[model samples]
Target: MIHVAIIGQGLVALHFEVGLEKLKNNEIPDYGVPLRNWLPYKYDDIEIVASYDVDESKVGKTVYELAKRDYPGNHIPGSLKDIVVSRGIHLNSMKGLPFKARGREEDKGIEAAINELVDEWRSLNIDVLINIMTTEPVEPVGNAGEIERRALNGDLTASQTYAYAATLYSAKYRPVAFVNAIPSPIANDPGFIKLCSERRCVVFGDDGSTGATPFTADLLEHMYERNRKVIDIAQFNIGGNTDFLALNLPERNIMKKKTKSAIVEDILGYDAPNYIRPTGYLEPLGDKKFVAMIVEYYSFGEFKDEFYVVMRINDSPALAGLLVDLSRIGRIALDRQAYGSIYEVNAFYMKRPGPPGSKAVSKYHAFQGLLNWLGISDPRMQQARR
Candidate 1:
C-alpha cells in the first residue's frame, strides 16, 4: 500500500480523498476518474496518511469534514474522519488573495518547521508527498546555492520548504516522492532537481496537465505530425476555483502562462505566435472551468484553416485522477530506487515536466510511454486491439 501525504488540503486533495474513499468501499463511479490501472496497483492500494494546509478554517478539521463540507452530496468514508489537517508554511502563496493564510513557521523557526514535517513524515510513514498548493509568484531560483541561500533567510516559497523537508525526511529515513501539481517550478528548478537526486527522493511536476493544457498539447502534436504550418494558437481557461483566484495576480499568472506556453515550441520544433494561459477567474464557474481554444494553421497551398472550440470540465477531479497515478508511480519508483524525476511519467501527466526542455508527446503516446516506464501493459489498449 502507498501511504500518501498532501501539502495542500484544497479541492484537488479533497477530491482525491473522496475518490479513494469511494474506491475503498468498492463504489466506483462510471465517469470522472479517467485513468483505469494506476498500474500494478488499484485505487484501494492508496492511503492518505497525513495532510497540511495554511487555511485557518481548514486546519484542525478532519479530512472527512473538509470533504463533506465542500462536497456534501458525496459519501466520505468514516476512516478519513480521523485524519486531522496540520498547519503548513504559507510563504507568499497567499499574497493578493482574499483569504489570510497562516503557517506554523510564524510561531516556530524555519529549522523547527522542517523538523516538524520530517517528524510527521517519519511518524506517518509517508511514501509520497503530493503538493497541490495554490500557485505562488516565485522568482525562479535556478541553482542549489541559491535555494540554500534563500531557504536560510526564509525567503523560499511554501512549496520549496515542503520539498526541502521531504528531501531531508527521505535522506534520514526512507525514500519518498514529491509530486508537485502547481506551477511553482520545483521539479524544473535545477536546484531542487540536484537536491532530490542527492537526497534519494523522486520528484515529478512543475505543473499538473489537465483540462485545456493537455488537450492543446495533443492538438499541437497533431498539427506537427500532419506537417501543417501552424500560424498561431490561442488557448485559455477561466475558473472559479481558488487557484484561478490566486492567478489573478499578474506575477502568479505569468508563471502559469510560462508552463502553458512552453509546449508549443517544444512540440512544433519552433515557436509560433501564440497566447496560451489562464485568462480569468469566474467564481460562479467553481471547479468547472470554461475552456476555449482557437488554432489557425496553413493547410494545402497556403489555405488558412481555423479551428475553434469551447467546453467546460471539472478542473479539480482531472488533477486528482492524475495525482492518483503519480502517487502509485512514485511508490513504484521508490521500490526501484529511481531517484530524481521520471520524465516518462511527467511527459504524460504534467504540462511542463521536470528535467526541463523535454518535448511534449501526444496523450496516447505519453500514456504508452508511462506504461512502459512502469513495466506494465495497458489492459485497455490490449482489449481495444482484440
Candidate 2:
C-alpha cells in the first residue's frame, strides 16, 4: 500500500481523505481523479496513514469527525476515523488568521520537532507527504546551504519545516515524495531542489492549478499558437475558504500573485500587463469561489478582440481531486528514486512548476507531456486511430 501523510488537515485534506476511501469502497465514482485506473497504483492501494495540523480544534480530532463537521450533508468514510490529526510545526502559518494554533516546535524546539516528525513518519512507513496547507509567504532560498542552515536553526516557515523534516525522513529511513499543493516554493527553490536531489527524494509543487489560472493558460496558448498579439490580461479569484482569508493578507496574497501571473509570460513568450491573484474572501461563499477574467488581444490586421469569463469554482474539491493523482504519482516516483522535482509532473498540476526557471505551459500541452512521462497513450486517440 502507498501510505500517505497529510501536512494540513484543512478542507482539501479532508476532501482527499474522504474521497479516497469512498473510491476504495466503491461508494463513489472517480469523477475528478484525472488518471484514474490508468496509474500503476490503484486507488484502493492508497491509504491515509497520518495527518498533521496546528489548529487546536483539529489536532485531537479524527479525519471522520472533521469531515462530518466540514461536510454536513455529505457521507464521510469510516476509514478516516483511524487517522487522527496530530500537531505539526506551526511557525505562525495561521497566526494572522483566527485559528488558535500551535506547533510541536513550540513545545520541543525545532530540532526535536523535526526529529519527532521524521521518527513518526518512519514508524508509519509513509511514502508520500501531501502539503495542502494555508498559503504562506516565502522566498526561494537560492543557496542549498542556506536551506540546510535555516532548517537546522528554525528560521523557516511552517511548510518549510515540514518539507525539511520530510528530507530528514528520507535520509534516515527511506525515500519519500512531498507534494506541496500550496504556494510555498518548495519545488521552485534552488536550495531545496539541490537538497532533495542529494537526499534522494521527490517534491512536486508551488501552488496547484485548479481554477481560472489553467483556463487562462490554455487561452493564452490559443492566442500564442495563432500569432495573436495579446494586449493585456486581468484575472482575479474570490472565495470564502480559509485559504482566501489567508490570501487577504498582503504577504500571502503576493505569493499567489507570483504563482498565477507567471503563466502569462511563460505561455505567451513575453510579459503581458496582468493583475491575477486571489482578490477577496466572503465566508458565506465557502469553498465555492467566484472567478472572473478578461483578456484583450489583437487578432489579424490589428483587430481588437476581448473575452470575459465568469465561473463559480469549488476551490477545495477541485484541488482535492488533484491530490489523488499527486499521491499515486508520488508513490510511483518513490519506486524510481526520482530525487528532486519532476518537471513533467509539476508542469501539469502546479501553477509554478519547479527547478527555478521552468516555463508554465498550457494544461493542454502539459497533459500530453504528463501522459508521455507516465508512458501511457491517450486511449481515445488510440481508438480514433483504430
Candidate 3:
C-alpha cells in the first residue's frame, strides 16, 4: 500500500480522495478516468495517511469535513474520514488569495517547521508526498547549499519548504516519492533535484499537464510530423478556481506561463510566434474552465490554414486523475531505486519536465519512454506495432 501525504488540501486533493474511494467501491462512472490504469498497482492501493494546508479554515478540520465543505452535498467516504489537515509552510503562497494565510511560523521557524513535518511524516509512514499547493512565484536556487541556507533563513517559498521537509524526512526514513503538482520548481529546480537525489527520493514534475498544455503538445507534434510549417499559435485558459484567482498576480502568472510555453520550442525545434497563458478568471464559471486555441500554419503550395479549437473542461478533476498516476509512479520509482527525477514519467505527465532546460518530447514518445522504463509492453505503443 502506498501511504500518501498531501501538502495542499484543496479541490484537487478532495477530488483525488473522492476518486480513490469511488474506485475502491467500483462506483466510478462508465465514462472512465483519464489516467492510463496500466500501472503496477490499482487506484485503491493508495492511502491518504495525512494532509497539510495553511488556510486557517482548512487547518484543523479532518479531510472528510474539508471535502464536504469544498464540495457540499458530495459523498465523502469513510476511508478519508479520519485524516486531519495539518499545518504547513505558508510563505506568500496565498498572497493574492482571498483568505488570509496562516503558517506554522508562530510556533517554529523554517528549520523547526521542516523538522516537525519530517517527524510527523516519519511516524505516519508516508511513502509519497503530493504537493497540490497553490503556485508560488519563485526563482530556482543555485545549488543544494543555497537552498538549505534559504530554507533555514526562512527565505524559501512554501513549496520549496515542503520539498526540503520531504528530503529531510526521506533521509531519516525510507525513500519517499515527491510529486509536485503545481508550477513551483521542486523537481525542475537543480537544488531540490540534487537534494532529492542525495536523499534517495523520487521527484516528479514542475507542473502537471492536464488540459490545454498537453493538448497543444499533441497537436504540435502531429503538425511537426506531417511537415506542416506552423506560423503562429495562441492558447489561453479562463477559469474560476482559486488557482486562477491566484494567477491574477503577475508573478504567479509568469510561473504558469513559463511552463505552458516551454513545450513550443522543444517540440518544434524552433520558437514560433505564440501566446499561451491563463488569460483571466471568471468566478461564475466555477471549476469548469474555458479553453480556446488558434493554430495557423502553411500547408503545401504555401496554402494557409487555421485550426480553431474550443473546449470546456473540469480542470481540477482532470489534474487530480493525473495525481493518481504520479503517486503510484512515485512508489514504483522508489522501489526500483530510481532516485532523483524520473524524466520518462515527468516528460509524459508534466509541462516543463525535468530540470530547467530539458527538451520536451512528443506525448507519444514520452509514453513509449515511460513504458520502456517500466518494462511494460503496451499494445497501443507505436513501438509495439514496429
lDDT of 1 by residue, 1-386 (tens): 89999999999998888877886687876254545654677777888888999898899999989877896355677898978999988776787788768888888887788788899889989999999998987755878777877776788989988888888899999999999989888888888888889999999987899998888888888898999999998888999999989888898899899889998998889899999999999999999999899999999899999899899999898888778778888888999999988899888888888876577677778888887887777776779999
lDDT values for all models: 0.86, 0.90, 0.86
Q: Model 1, 152: alpha-carbon shift in Å?
A: 2.9
The pairs that clash in candidate 1 are none
- Candidate order by lDDT, decreasing, is 2, 3, 1
lDDT of 2 by residue, 207-239 (tens): 889988888899999999999999998888889
What TM-scores do the predictions have? 0.96, 0.98, 0.96
Q: Is candidate 1 or candidate 2 better by lDDT?
A: 2
Q: Which regions of candidate 1 fall more than 4 Å away from where they truly are?
A: 30-35, 380-386
Per-residue lDDT of candidate 3, residues 25-109 (tens digit):
8877513243457777777788888888989999988888877778633667877778888888887679867896788965777
Look at candidate 2 and tell me the lDDT of residue 329.
96
Error of 1 at 267 (Å): 1.0
Q: What clash count does candidate 1 reach?
A: 0
